[model samples]
Target: MRYGMAIDTKKCVGCSDCVVACQTENNVPHGYSRDWIAETVEGTYPDLAMEIRSERCNHCDNTPCVRTCPTGASHVTEGGIVKVTHEECIGCGACIESCPYDARYFHPDGYVDKCTFCDHRVKNGQDPACVSVCPTHCMYFGDLDDPNSEVSKKVATRKTKVLAPEAGTKPQIFYLI
Candidate 1:
């Protein structure tokens, strides 16, 4: 099954709850964000507008991280989550540099780290930590291939965009742009 996210940028309040939830749930180290918000400034003065985007691993079907992992640590799960075998990781940081969106980061243990879409929770039949904790309900997670799922319906009815589509990564993540 293809998995992806539907993020409502307009509803996003720039709150960092999603970031903290991911870090806490995954035991991600302090000072490193597995997923986080980015702000872009536009207009000026009274007309200034801030765009908030919650970013993580896109879990691209054609993932560059998986391709560049020399030791074969990073790969896609059957559910479409980009996952890394921490023990097999050699702290090479190839994945970090490969991400076109600057989504990946180096963990304290030197392994490349990014969002797993909370595979641990998904495996347990739960939503991703970030999606579960989002107060504004800005994030939606579900099987992208299922026509009845919210994610699939939203992508079908609305125009959505992913970061760096030019990379040809075929990212499953979508934004309600």
Candidate 2:
């Protein structure tokens, strides 16, 4: 099962609710965040187009983070969730350097940390904190391998894009435009 997330950019309001939820639920340090809202504005003046998205680890199928980890701390878990084993991490920052999405951060406790898609919560049949608390309900998460899953259906039906696709990471996060 390839777990993934589909975020509707048209529905997102740049409220940062998902960011706050991720921090509170993950117990992230005050200065750090596992996810954040990114906004892009293009064109000129009144003709400008704006896209706001909640961004985090892409959980790539061809993860450069996992490939660059000298200590094997960065690894892909079940359902394509990329995670760092804090105990095994040597704080080398290799994974952080390799991530095209700039998702990994060095923790205060001297290890790397990033989004997990709230694997603990997912295992309990609950959504990720970010997805659960999105006020606009723009986020959808489920097994992408299952054609009937919400995420899969959304990806199949909507116009979507993945960040840094040229990097060839095969990122699982989809931005529905």
Candidate 3:
């Protein structure tokens, strides 16, 4: 089944709890983020509004990173999750350069790094780290194919957007923009 995440930006409180949880759960390398938040402030002084986005691997359907990886170490799972194999990677940094979302990282261990949607946890019947620990309950995770699922329900009922639609990546992560 295809799985993805949909995050409600309105409910996000700019808390870093999700970030710290993902870092610990995935064993993501230090000095770099597997998941991070970005913000854009708009309008005049009195009408200021902050747009906060929690971003990671876009897990594009037409992933440039997957196509650019010489060793085939960076690829997408059937569930629409992008993963980089630390051991198989040559650390050529090609994927890092090719990723439009700035998702990939070249670790100090001489291998490529990126988010895997906490695959280990998912395989163990757990939600992705970020989803499980989001303090505001803004992040939702479920099978996109299941119409009755929470994620699908949100998609059907709300307005959402994916990052970099012009890139033709068809990202799995959606935002309530």
* Residue 5 displacement (Å), model 2: 0.4
Q: How close is candidate 1 to the true structure, as a TM-score?
A: 0.93
Among these predictions, the greatest TM-score belongs to 2
Candidate 1, residues 110-153: lDDT per residue as tens digits? 77788889887888888999999999998989999899998889
If scored against the real structure, what TM-score would every candidate get? Answer: 0.93, 0.99, 0.95
Q: What residue pairs are clashing in model 2?
A: none
Can you write out model 2's per-residue Cα lDDT over 44-147, one digit (the tens) per residue? 99999999999999999999999999989888999999999999999998898999999999999999999999999999999999999999999999999899
Shift in Å, residue 118, candidate 3: 0.6
> Please, what are the lDDT tens digits per residue for candidate 3 over residues 1-177?
888889998888888888899878877678778889988899999999898988988777888998999999988786888888777899888888888899877777889888888888888878988999888899998889999999999988999999989888889899986
Ranking of models by lDDT = 2, 1, 3
lDDT of each: 0.87, 0.96, 0.86
Off by over 4 Å in 2: none
List residue ranges in candidate 1 displaced over 4 A. 44-49
lDDT of residue 57 for candidate 3: 87
Q: What is the lDDT of candidate 1?
A: 0.87
The window of 10 residues in a row where model 2 has the poorest summed lDDT is 92-101
